[model samples]
Target: MPITYDSQKRIFKLDTKTSTYALLVYRENYLVHLYYGAKLPDDNLASLMYRGRFDSLSPYNPKVEDELFSPDINPLEYSTNGAGDFRISACSVRGENGDTVTDLRYVSHRILPGKPKLPGLPATFAGEDEAQTLELETVDSVTGVRAFLLYTVFEEYGVITRSVRFENRGSAPVVLERAYSACVDFPGMDFDMVHLYGRWAKENSTARHPLQHGIQSIQSKRGMAGPNHNPFVALARNGCTEETGEAYGFNLIYSGNFAIDIETDTRGCSRLLMGINPTDFRWKLSPEESFTTPEAVLVYSDAGMGGMSRTFHKFYLNHLMRSEWAKKKRPLLINSWEAAYFDFDDDKLAAFAGEAQKLGIEMLVMDDGWFGNRCDDHRALGDWAVNEQKLKGGLQSLIQRVNALGVKFGIWYEPEMINPDSDLYRAHPDWAVCARGRDKSISRYQCVLDMTREDVRDNIFRQMYDVISKNNIEYIKWDCNRHISEAASLQLPPDRQGEFFHRYVLGVYDLMDRITTAFPHILLENCSSGGGRFDAGMLYYSPQIWASDNTDAIERLTIQFGASLCYPIASLGAHVSANPRTSLKTRGNVAMCGTFGYELDPVKLTEEERALVRRQVADYHKYYDLIRYGDFYRLTSPTDNPFFCEWEFVSEDKTEALTTLVVMRQPEHVFHIQYLRGLDPDRLYREEETGEVYSGALLMHAGLNLSCVSWESPDGDSLVRHFTAV
Candidate 1:
């Protein structure tokens, strides 16, 4: 196995029983040659998805062992001679007893690009236990060029950590400039796309390349909150293919200098390339340098985040979650709308949490009905105050009391809205996004607050901060019910009415940014009537989202399956079993592919049903780490691969990967579980329930087959196999 990495002294060293040799020069930032031990065809970076940003003339630094590696990680060695490739040494990788460790595991490499790429570009990872900051200075101090970087070649337990940071340095400063682009090259996909955002019904601009067709890209203004936030959400899936290779398959290009074009390859895969335009502000030092806003270009690879492999990818995200226990992930949690809709109160809330706790739940969130006049969601749209009528006490007191019971407390809030009937709306009246001359009817009992306005921004921010600060609130169900309507006003002038959606989203970001900054300890879940706002823009601010309002497991299967194509599992909110799913038709396990949680009334469940919930929790607890943070691979899409949904999560080293096969037998059964990809060439694993032993070799080569399938598991109907290397 060749576990390679590069710094100033770049080199690739392979490990074998016979001997170890340093592979001669290939280009830098190239890993295919390093991992596959193949020669680069022509050995050039011109076609390697080139990302150029005069603004981001810096490098991305990789974390060295001493800098961040845990016990599972050993540092790089140092050579006898100081700094040349032949002389550049590793930090002497030693086993637990300093023996030449032989059981080499992970084979990895990284191209740590430097910065101008501002600090704090939103990151995605699984598992928790976070350090306070991500401080990697990879730029050349003299030239202001960023080249410092690091990568790991693992030898211990697959536990890995992910983090990123930028510590403001130098006297005269430069504005941060960065790009969201991939480094690999692939063949391409078969379809065109329209990147989407805004309302599903009416959307904004659809991005396209110079000359294109059928496929369009929708740039969503939806976002998780932060200061001066510009959401980076645009799609391109033209040249990437799943049929060709792994790692170097798909990409979304972001040209830091040119108009950012979001494009895909020949496969059906997608990417949201992001970059910032040069702005001279936010700079206090140096000659007046240029600045570009950061973009949200996030994509999830399914291979890195399930089962034990999730532990490997955890290294990429520790900066955000900041909690080790949180990294372990909790039981699948469920909320009420999918369970009882808008049901009971305090005692009711307590009952749900208690029952959930019995079933291994870690937290309980009080959804819509617990607030002021919120029964059925028609009234109290702008109200932030607690409804004494429902909880019988203030929100803080209720939360405090709930915490005493050993369960975390979460609440719902929608500050960017105002029902004209609401007191705030009644008092200000001008607070809504409406026009005076024509008309502004209501949607969902309220209108959106002109989040684009400074005052409106203040009001929203203050109230939101108040809720998190004053109360022991651990989780927030941040919701934005209706999309921008009437397009009249909040803060923007009349001529810029069309700018409402974009600016309004900025306002939302401002509020959320403040809340999260001040209360870094809290976890926020974003929901816009479920999948309505599922996009990369929102993922920047929210760790999880309400996958969909439709709780019907069957319908959810379709909805969530479509959603998984873009988002990662950690950000995808799902539950175990909910009161017989409420949908057009009775369904099967609707939520088995996300941060599993329940939203049902514990008091209402029968003993057997409750036990089922408990069992579901156990299943979640067992696999939570695997699904929440591992790489997400969408093997089959209901839209494309109906009747069969196959996916897997592989550890970083690719040693172990878990695959789940969901078989929908409408009447196609020629089973023996063969003919699937990545089956154990060495096949060593077993069915958790059936205990039927198998070889990793046969499993990977011949695959397993199933006939007479039944939708039984309340956890979701599927075949889950854990492939381990013995």
Candidate 2:
């Protein structure tokens, strides 16, 4: 049992046995030495983040630390230790000789030139000199587990991002079950009751993580100035489920400010964003489990957006995303449920795809309903094999036509679901996720597939990749129609029933890996119902998601906004299309972000609207690189600033800029205007509206009264401003 701890330095180490697991993270800087769990220690514990220990490299000096460096005071907080800093106090199980009764569980913070174990999380800073390249390595030798860190180092934008990845490469297969909490010292916020929300699971901002029975995520009812700041915080519990199963994940948090990005991964192979808490980790774990390989955590951060993050994560992700790739190499162009409904015929599909080809949209995908003798949404789910009646020909013939259209073809399949009328289900009714002995419930007229069963998983893979392997298909939209998490699979061992969700996902990854290995060029777009189950885990395989079925451009603003907060924009499936929102009459900015494509009939729009869309497609190509790889910044808000919201993409140079300022008219007797900062700080900037010149700070902080006196932004119209450094 290798262990190490540094109480005096407020650092902890576990590289070797006999090394004390003495570190405990309490409140910001106060790490307690828990080497002797039974004994109450002395000055062994002091406020590390407070009094003066901000960091070893840059010691915290209350006098020198600005609001940017110092921890912002939390409004609602009650530490178990009766100390405000105790809000984050944590301790490991008492040492072998110590009693948990007297010793406090100490949390570990990574030590700079020392072993402080806060582990490189990320920097929550905005000032020019506040950023740092902080990294941490956490390993459990006894368990043979490891997590690594790689963080972005831009300090001016007021944030630091770190990505952490971990794996259990041990001898004994063990599940790494642990509770991760974001115990913020921010007052007004309730840690116990605060539920964290982000892009890992949602379509628009409205789609949120499933709640844990009695909790609502901590959101700023009012922003920082008003009463709170809402940074993305998620508490996930995961570990090994199989002997040799490999896993990888990432998390991003922007502290110091709510909306600004601190780090992002733009140069890496993954093309992701945000930050990591760990790095290159080999879990020579469970020599008995059968699997052995190093697991990794990817940490990315941004000044909100820039490099690959800002361009892709912040902006482009919402407009255009590069899929995992295929034989032909391009996104599998898709016409989702919202596009064709049940109106597609083989000839119609081929003719319709003709339009997609005119725009360089690669693989043409047909989503929903082409299976189980199905004609509508209500039937033939989970039923493998194509419905001959719908296509009037076998699946291969239809695919050939799409291929003939000079485009690769993709088909949607929700393998995890089954319709009661499906041949497979009717033969094995119990295969669906239903309450054993009790009637089962179904969503979207289907039940979950018992993927835990080897047979089920095999059946899915067979039709999924095997069918495509036999045909000219190059892409697949893996759709999960419903959340069938509760039903018990009689086929699984009792204790393993709980392992369904994670395993189902893992199975998906395995299937994708196999398919990609077999085809290498076959791309995948994971869809859950519409945009459910959108997460980084899935992204490693499925490069894009169906976004949301909501076609309203206005609602998309809020939706895409929430989505961009966690995931890089490259992952969202956004398109420019028809007006009059489909789901709810709400408006949307269908043109601004994420995989830019159209789901509407290009022929339906008026000539002017069509012309506008045509231009947008071209415009996307113009800034595609910037949007795909620049820095992202939130300039406005749909929150209190609902009348307008703004975002910007700044080149790494800090000189060039591309700003999207959406203006919604308010009856304040005026029009919409945008402001910016760091624009030469003192240099004069020319306004986009007119040849107006003004000092950068004056307009950025105060205001640059702008009036589109001639016209106001349509109730939800936005003005796209492309900036260039003079």
Candidate 3:
């Protein structure tokens, strides 16, 4: 069993394959954390709890009788405001009588065979045989507010998912000022904080800093989980490396305004908190109403960041993503957005598809101008009708033409946006999210649709469902181009106005659920102006996401590297684009790390380029499984070395490996040695092209000597090496 309870000690221990988390009920009531690290034997681990005598000098509840009962300094399982803990709280509520203090004592707990679903939220789920859940119920004595701390342990994956549910059991209405999903209290502060941070075109850039006094956090307040900051934080030991030492990760399974906060108090203790951002967020819970926070995935890796990443990848692939195509090989697609943006007709699209078919591309996605007066980015966003003038025979004809050429067809839709000139907006102007008397702010020449309104969401979903059902389209690139501005919904009452952001996210999930359920075969890819909405919540519906708009091969090295810290490479939508004018081979090699595709006019390529495209498509098929399901290792980072970047994917069984080395600038030397990982030291591996055999230990320790002849010559600045065990 993953979870075990010691009733005599009043202790709960959650164990995974590589880690153990133990907590105990101290003083017969208060829940306190004991240990979280490498796996420990299920014996008397209660001594791991730090019981300092000086902790009594910190803040305490005067009403409590115990002398060493300071909630401020103790390692609390779940800390609440007004109970004496002042650093950062998990839940805060104002009672009907204006009382803010909450003293929650453990009431009961139940150990279940499987994980329970989080209501209206995306969470990791598992079969009864694969996981176990522990639910601990605690109630505030004064207000009768009940809190349930739920923990689901995926023993094999070394992951524990946590969530909190609050129910008002008292007579009066309670306003929830702040509610976080999970909180962890550490006994020491000898760690480094690592997070992903970036802007629109450059999403998920890695940043790390040392732990310091006071609070430091990464947050998003732009309504959706904006591209600026991702909702993931990791604490690594001082000397932790990619392949060694301890690392703890927390990722939220939500795509709204989120915050991940870490604080080091005066006593050198650290606290980590993650959940919905309290800024511009509030929920009113009536006596019988309950609110469930999103799930926060926690991973402990004594084997370092690589192990942590592999754990997350495996867990998300098997549990979080629920599409038939989750484990299937993705198609090598050609998108028309960058090639002929708003200027292609039916014949042009058919010609593009014809070229793609000849080069072995499996799909041709018609992006942005196939529907309604959408010649440019300025108009016709909410309108979902086919433009007969451009298509000449409608969407069905285009799909048929593309399909006849041995390529599937995909179409793009911005269902959450509304252009002022669009018919849908002109008819129901109030459907656009805007303050009652304020001028609607425009982003990308469009306003966001008020998805918080059920009618608005239903209308949009119906339009999309009708189009997808009537046509033979196999894929949909759902895009949300802008963030919410003037977040006002006419349908919501004044007191509930603060609920608009979260409710809007729920509406998005609802629409996504409906469409995905109705058309389960479509390959849905989510995009938010190129990686804006690239979050785990969106991954629950879409198997892949358009990684970014910046297709520059050199820039993408960093972008993709940073994103891989939490997200699996298979979920990133990357394409060989004709921007930055890099070598075609380099472009193809850079994109091979993700869901490989193209965003260029295939017909415009020379015969040599066409041959390279054929080889790239063939390579995609050859290594699709390995790249999709392999253990990824970051050998070198572009942020650390401006001249080059290197990474590799090794199969789980250590039989095969594929490594890519990209040179952004000419190196001063003629050759460089690249060390590899995740290989069997006793085996001899033969290089695919050179046929040269070397021991795995030699390649991993002494490194492979890679000549820069091809990189320096006109061939390309990128090299991909494949090795197989002999």
Name the top lDDT candidate: 3
lDDT of each: 0.45, 0.45, 0.88
The candidate scoring highest on TM-score is 3
On residues 117-158, what C-alpha lDDT tens digit does candidate 3 reach at each position? Answer: 888888888989999999999998777789999999999999
For candidate 3, what is the TM-score?
0.98
The Cα RMSD of model 2 versus the native structure comes to 12.8
Tell me the tens digit of each residue's lDDT in model 1 across 206-240.
Answer: 22233232232322222222111113232233343
**Residue 201 error, candidate 3, Å:** 1.1
Residue 211, model 1, lDDT = 20
The lDDT of model 3 is 0.88
lDDT of 2 by residue, 438-474 (tens): 7777666777777656677777777776567778877
lDDT of 1 at 297: 25
